[model samples]
Target: MAICIPPLDASTESSAERKLHEALRSGLSDDFLVLHSVKWIAKPRGAGPRDGEVDFLICHPKHGLLVVEVKGGGVILDYAMRRFASIDRHGDEHEITNPFEQAMRGKFAILEKLKESPFWQKLGLGRIPLGHAAFFPDVDGVGGLVGPDAPLDIIGGRQDIALISQWVDRAFTYWAGPGGQGALSELGAGGVATVQRILARVSTTRPLVSARLVQEEQTRIELTERQAAILDLLSRQRRVMVAGGAGTGKTLIAREKAARAAEEGLKTLLVCYNRGLADHLREQCEGIEGLDVATFHQLCKRWIDKAKSELGRDLMAEARRDYPGGTEFDHHQPIALAFAIDAFGPNYDAIIVDEAQDFGDEFWLPIEMMLSDHADGLLYVFLDENQNIYGRSAAIPIKGEPMLLDKNCRNTTTIHAAAYRYYRGVRIEAPEITGTKIELLTAPDIDRQARAISALVTRLVAVEGVAPHDIGVLLCDGRARSSFERALAAMTIPKSSRWGHLEGYGQGSITVDSVAKFKGLERAIIILWGLDASDPVVDRETLYVGMSRAKSMLYLCGTVAACGRVLDAGVA
Candidate 1:
């Protein structure tokens, strides 16, 4: 684990030292312990200038201890006089502090500190070996230092950096002897352990996080730096509304804020309009305590279930009798809301609603009433009015101006440009493209569309190298799910694939979800099917939702008329 002692003095570090620090950090393994820009106290308190700074003190189990002093400017070495001088960019030479001498002083100070430290003093290190070197990152050459008097072995430029491990090995052999036949042979393994304990006195600047953990974190949907900053700002407010275009990471920010609230011991509820999105959030927040994830209807159901015992009436039974089995809950939401409010009031510390644009003004009232009375009670809503395919045009029920997130980090520039042109009236910041242009495919009928989509998926897997889970096939019309399934069956794709009607696939399975279901989620590549511009207004929003789901690549498949609506701004 890397460590820092007494923090860093930025003013004291030359440009060369900074560059060398970054180089060593990137080159070295995590197993090595490093302390950089450190102040080593030479003596007991007030005994002259005690603070002696060193550029870096690196420690490893096999390499023992290494101290490095960095110099940035050009250097002139006099072999006869054994003097070192610094040369500036203007070719003027100036006498500078000898790096070797500085390293030695810092080394002495470090040893003294180790001996004085109670933790290290107990180790009882006896004559532990240490290596010191001078690094010149800016200097390309050293002149006048030749023959036996030259300290070529101790001084190094950039070219010599690759041989540092060999140098450390030589130092270990010289001071401790080769193999088990070293100077500390009598002390054995115990003495080496003590020396390591001495060098480990420096404090770590940050906790050790594994590379795998970092990689996993990177794989998860991430917010841009600006979006993260806005999230931070929202945390400080009592109520907030965030509005962003597709791929702007609004849902990611909502989940993050909900997770943070749970971490802070708040009773948090994360709600979204899409059932698939709610399930996704629930899975993402699996182990988080005091955090509940559910769709708006699911949340209302829970409240209704609670009211059954208190009101001494089966509210769900009444709803079922009225709305019947296959009825959508959007029309019954107000009834559920009334029942929920009468049953429970203000039980949660924070309420975060995602896909808020899909909710009517009244849908938020019961949710707002669920917040606790504390001043810090939070009600954060994230939305994108442009993607409001559900036709909820009422004003949102919340206070304060919504913070706008214009950056689209999810899609490549090409796909985002197409989506922007489709919705030209809305404000959308152009995204930085790092992938291929969107592929618009035409098929005369559903049969040909299916074949084309299957081929695209095949090429994406074989040629583009995208993983199965990273790919998605979106169908807007529910009726097209079976046709695509039959076409995919004809292609004999793996049985591991999942349709939206089935249970959760979790990960590692290609998903086929409707555009409405796939909202608030994204994939590396997308194959959009079943968009027909016969109803241009409906098809535009649906097609927009499908195309925006692709982060890197988008393969659009439909009749020529449907694909044309996507290219032209035909939907209002």
Candidate 2:
């Protein structure tokens, strides 16, 4: 088979080594699979190389496995000590680990890895033939070769790549065992298939560096000219309402303005409707002095606590009366806002609110109470009415006319087209950008939906090469969280929840959250799981928020009936 080299960055590799690698890639027959920079996690121990990085692992159907260690520069072999060194251009000798020993440890690590993977054991591939080789591309292989015991047959220069290939074939010609089973010659068709399967499983490849993803993240956070102009005007104008549809950079603008306010030595309080969105904003604005980030309820709770002593009224009792048997602090937001308007207020130089659509009329009175006395002190509001999932469509009580941010800087054109259907009344702009089309997956039940989600996650990670954090699996409501969790567990795909503080969640782990919880947050790839079309109005609003959360890729997963309703709602 044609040689297949895994993704690698040639910048860190030596010129000679790169040249040799290219030659091998071109020269090897279709039977060989050459993988570079393969990684395997091994338990930490005092022994050799602790099973981390392997330079190269070559697998062939007929030849079995070969672990090759490539070295650059003039390789010097010590005849007496039997050690290895490389001489630099200035004639400096740098002692190096023996390539043969390094390759042998890597071989052992691979064996250990295979032992741990139950998938490999099920394949029935027994004893796998293993070989080791040290490649020195700068060393002369054609003439003046090292004497016997020098491993000249395996240790060769660029000229002997074909010779090395021949040596590999010869090495495995007489080798016995399938892996842990009988001899290679005694293996049947099934056993041979098992060998192929095992080889494929052990081969893992990722680029040494992903410059494209880095650049994409940078560009995403950077503001466009129009957005900058609006931000500039809003920053200077002080008190104004900013209106925009999903992906219009409303959240980002709010954040920038808040950051600027804090930088100007003004005490700022940045608030949002959703607790999750508040937490996200807090994380983004971390380390900015003179800034306090909190949810609307959180802000209300602070004032409510103070109002107890000043108002001479039991605010908790009043809140319970307003929302009977409610345990959450949000249930008291209206009562607290009313209390603040009547009895308590703390002046903040700047108060910025995001996800303003989720707030009710009572919220604005308290916001007004906290406004600073100075003219430059700002109170900015950002809203996208279509995203108001709670059906609270109250107008933001701001003095000046709302500045409209029409251009969307987040989602790609394809994604925007799919999301814009639900936002019909808004002037959603679509730039000439290309991206994956919105995908709608229909399943019979939760089980099938889980399977579909699992498969999609694998494809996005392995095929499209998207990072796990960039991918989010969002549920329509918290009740569906268990079903998605069950699906993920059934598929054996480990994922982190976005519900709590998530202290120990690794950045590379896939995130699971409700669509409502993920409002004001953006991911590169989003899978909206367990959409309920029973209430078309509610479902439409929820899906509108979830669909726009994906910056580039969007996957809608639900039952056939639910999907039909979504399609009827004009969102695909």
TM-score of each: 0.59, 0.56
Estimate, for each residue in 262-337, the C-alpha lDDT of model 2 and write its tens digit: 6544678899877666766676678987889998888777777777777667777787787786554444666656
TM-score of 1: 0.59
List runs of model 2 lying over 4 Å from the truth.
Answer: 1-217, 306-314, 318-331, 337-345, 374-377, 462-464, 494-506, 532-538, 560-572
C-alpha lDDT values of all predictions: 0.66, 0.66
Best by TM-score: 1
lDDT of 2: 0.66
Alpha-carbon lDDT of model 1 = 0.66
Model 1, range 1-572, lDDT digits (tens) per residue?
A: 23333233575446776666655655566655567765432234333223455788876655566678877778875645767788888999888777777777777777665555444545565665676767787765543333352256556676655555554444345445455435541333443344344432211111111111222234443456678667647645667888888878787778777876665446789998887777767877788888999988888777877777677667656656676642446545546655567566677877899998898765766776777643546788898877888888656766777888888877888888776655634477877766787777798887777777767766666676655667778887766678777766666444444333313544446777677877877777788877763355656676677788887788777888777765665554
Q: Where does the lowest 10-residue lDDT sum fall in candidate 1? A: 203-212
Q: In model 1, what are the clashing residue pairs, if there are any?
A: 176-182, 413-433
lDDT of 2 at 38: 59
